[model samples]
Target: MMVSYHHKNSGQFEDICVADLDYAFTNVTLPDREGRWCVGVAEGKIVEIVEGDRLNAQHVWHLDGKLLTPGLVDAHTHIDKAFTAESLGDVFAQSGLASAIQAVRHLKSQFTIADIKQRATQALQWSIAAGTTAIRTNVEADAFVELRAVEGLLDVQRSLSDQIDIQLVAFPQEGWFAIPETLESGASTYVEQALQHGIKVIGGNVNQGLWSSNPEAQVDALFDLALRYNCDLDLHLDNWDSAEAFTLPYVAQKTIEHHYQGRVAVSHIASLIHVSDSQAQVAIELLKQAEISVTVLPTRIKLTRVAELLEAGLNVVCGTDNLRDPFIRYGDADLLKALFLLAQLTGYMANRDLERLWQTISNNAAKMLRLPYGINVGNLADLVVFDAYSIPEAILHQATRLAVFKSGKLVAGTMQDQVLSLHKPDFMSPRRWT
Candidate 1:
């Protein structure tokens, strides 16, 4: 059944022929061992999913049998942080890592909304170019409310809404507990305040530095607020090196205790990555049972590896965290780099794990963002078509995204061999709760 569906993003997607459809549409689900073989997008949503026919479209584009995974969803990031970080300096532009840091350190006080807007725009555009459809970036609200970051990204969202997807994970980047714990100061109340202004609360990885007050109490307070606001949770936990930084079990326990439905995302759960084999296994089980997900920033982790943790089976999703910013430098919001690094580190770039790895960048990440459960239709009608047919080959060879569409609109595509790509696949990196 060929249905006519179109979007301003993908352009006039009409009379799509399903004669060459590869996979069965009835089983709309996360990519299995076989992966999403073929999809039928109609009316800005997947409508007619056919089993097999090679589903040639009348006015159609072919994926060349490449793995047809769902669009990417970056579960965690510091986009707003990137905004503040960018104004500090052209960290990436300066090849000298030391020079970049020095420059950024000097300008820490120079960060402004104008700088944020420019940097945010550049970051979002860079992410879009990397096949990420959706991304959740943390925005820090200082005393001034640096609303420009929100306004700039929101404008990017609206402008690229047809092509990219984004979630404003308005986060208090600094620390909720660090500001003297004064309700009058508003540091402790920042998360709630951001939520009040329509910002979703992303939890913090309260362990060291700011968490000096009392890690357990700080964490419990975050959980309590997340439960109270009924919003998603993402945190900057154990971002660097630290063995005692593991709070997954505690966080999971709190989630269960709260009986919360909102998602929990932990960035740089690097602590678990360093745990012993036995402990890692136990932690994985606990995380799985608690329905918690982890986002591992590849570049950052590369700067800080705990060994064998990559070998341990954990639901770790790769991310481009703190790109060209203060903390860690150089990442153009490229999940490709993250995926490549994941393969190098986890040794999962071989057979099934290779395919599974792709899911973390797309399907799994989208699920974490609660896409399937929300208004996920009519979203730019974008698709990432690879030049390769075999999943393993597609990844091994760094298969180019032959074509990228938004709302059925062509955003980026190769001329000779159609390689699908998107500016921000959804402005994100994929890893999900399910």
Candidate 2:
């Protein structure tokens, strides 16, 4: 059977014939399909996904019974400050969020355009090599770094457009109005400059204003900017340990007030884990009502009640928020590692739980970004093939990504070799070899 399909790549759509596929992946494991399946790609879009060994294409990739999934999406990250651990030195060794923020602010004061570009581009390459096809990174826009951070990331976004989709958020890490200079100098003006430089999202940390006279006003201000600029809102909400600092409900209320239901996302609401059950339930209900999504960075915090958030019917996703930065001293830009940490932190060890965790970094994150690729017919051909049997195994072992495809084009591939020798020293061996 032949079918005509519309192929879209890099926002350009064209009609193509499914029978003349440019490439096909055979003997791959697909969800909700029986036996080994085949995925046919033409003009950088998936044309046919059928249950069979159909490999009659110009190019064929034999999966050898490996797991194939939609390309990974990093819903939340900080690319501007990535890979700055060594430069920050031992000042952040035993620090919490507050001290880390201070150290990063100091570092940002010394940021040069070339330095930011080099570090951020390296991070993007590492992420792409690790099978991330899309990333929504928060670029800081404070009085220190100003618009240079946005410029650095914009360059990376343009350079990697074909290999990965990069969405930049004009993030005011210090705060919107809490910092006197930020407010006096027009913080919105800085964010506006970032938007003018091609940022598609606006980010703020409402918790920075919790001690202020009116924190709700700060949330309202960010929502107003989002509405005015016609960009999505991704806020850093309530990331502390005190339950009293939780402001997710307020963010949700503002989302409803602005009628910005699905366009809002709140990241690192770690305080929710410390709040009372009743309190958390109220916030979750409000989040569900507003349709605001959540992104959890399990490595950056002590704990996150991801299972509860998922059970509450909220669109919960996960990301590698920081990679060796002042905020988080460790990360390899690996989403699988983040997933493993999330499972261990939440004690979600069941098969279903692991599967859900996979979705957190893949499908759920994709939904938040509104990306146009998945394991389905008539979608963009962005996928990752892993050297694992099932989702549980993939999460447990953190298997190597055999291949990664962006718009049906091979971008990264890995082949590893290992050799182990079994030998004992004469002091410990019962029988020594002569």
Candidate 3:
């Protein structure tokens, strides 16, 4: 019993092929664009995007006007230490950053490559299912852990390269120069080794008296390594809850001096929220001049003045910092949940604001990582179709990802037997109060 059907009102038969890209999406709305279009993907790239309901492929998915966006990007996460909260208990779960660091220190020596791989792989799988096609995770690199986390993450990266794009940062959770073990090389030496071994980015912590007694020296050391290794720099700076923990301006100055504009990213910067508007304005302008991107982790710490930074025309993106770790006892490695919390915290309720905020997890994050992103012809076909018509609707409902594609292949979510199904759930409906 063979069933033959023409593609809608076009009165043309669809071409069939036995390949991964032998599918087309019709009646799908692109973000911030009017009307629906048929997007044709082939050979891991977007080939055609025409304004009509045409199949043009073997398999046709009539989205019925669902929003199709580029796959989400989690720019900053500690996947090396993800899913470790249950074993440590509630005391460290709610504790401050110092206590969380202490707790991890006690357990770092016991972390094997296999254990790290198991936990990080699970977190990555959850992220992929949630529509994240790319991520930049920080791996701890210090005397105690040495390069164990880096080695484990490299293995996971290679294993999951087909499903998602993973970038690793050789991060020194403790200060680079504050090692007590004379038997091992300094943190800087280990970071370079990770870079030599295949890490493309260098990470630092600039909390002044905490991460490093001399923040300027630490910044110099990081920049030196980054320049020498020809890698990008990502730093954890001013994450403390005090205005006095100010090293952003210095970091910005260094970026300009080193001619490393657009090659550096800073996370947290929570102290910016405590500083005065005038001081914050100065710092924001410096960041803009340095072309440095700011990644805000809403789940892990109080957000900086996000609205003000965006108003200053600074590149401000968001990330999921931790997943069930000591620092953030609650996380699922889902950027939508992180975005929901960010929207609520920043009061981004307007339509325009929601659309712009959506970019934090998609376009902005990609731009920060220098990835070629978006739903356009010639771009990589890493896209997600959500069960919502508009950006605001998607964010408001934390919309279900109807289908997730990586390199033109279905990696997560539904898309199988989708067009043939008669029984479909109403994913757009909200819960009723009655």
Model 2: CA > 4 A from native: 7-19, 94-100, 178-186, 208-213, 415-434
Q: Which candidate tops lDDT?
A: 3
Collision count of model 1? 57
Better of 2 and 3 by lDDT: 3
lDDT of 3 by residue, 69-141 (tens): 9999999999998888776777553776566666777778778899999999999999999999999999988
Residues 48-160 of candidate 2: C-alpha lDDT, one tens digit per residue: 88776765688777775567888899999988888888877656566754566667777898998889889888888889888999999998886888888988888888888
State candidate 3's TM-score.
0.90
- Compose the digit string of candidate 1's lDDT tens values, residues 1-434: 55454454557665554553332222222244343333555445554554443344434443333444455567667675564544544555554644553454345335565666677777877776666677777766534354445555555556667767778766555456644542212344655666776766555646553344555676788877876787778777665456677666677677767765347767666666565767767766666666666676667544323233334444556667776666655677877667777777766645667777776677657666766521133343455555454555556666565555554455665523232333334312222112
What's the C-alpha lDDT at position 386 in model 1?
52
In order, the Cα lDDT scores of the candidates are 0.57, 0.79, 0.83
Candidate 1 wrongly placed segments (more than 4 Å): 1-39, 51-58, 62-67, 81-109, 144-148, 179-186, 273-281, 302-315, 373-380, 415-434
Sort the predicted structures by lDDT, highest score first.
Answer: 3, 2, 1
User: lDDT at 113 for candidate 2?
Assistant: 84
The clash count of every prediction, one per candidate, is 57, 0, 0
Q: What TM-score fits each model?
A: 0.75, 0.89, 0.90
Alpha-carbon error at 300 in model 2, in Å?
Answer: 2.0
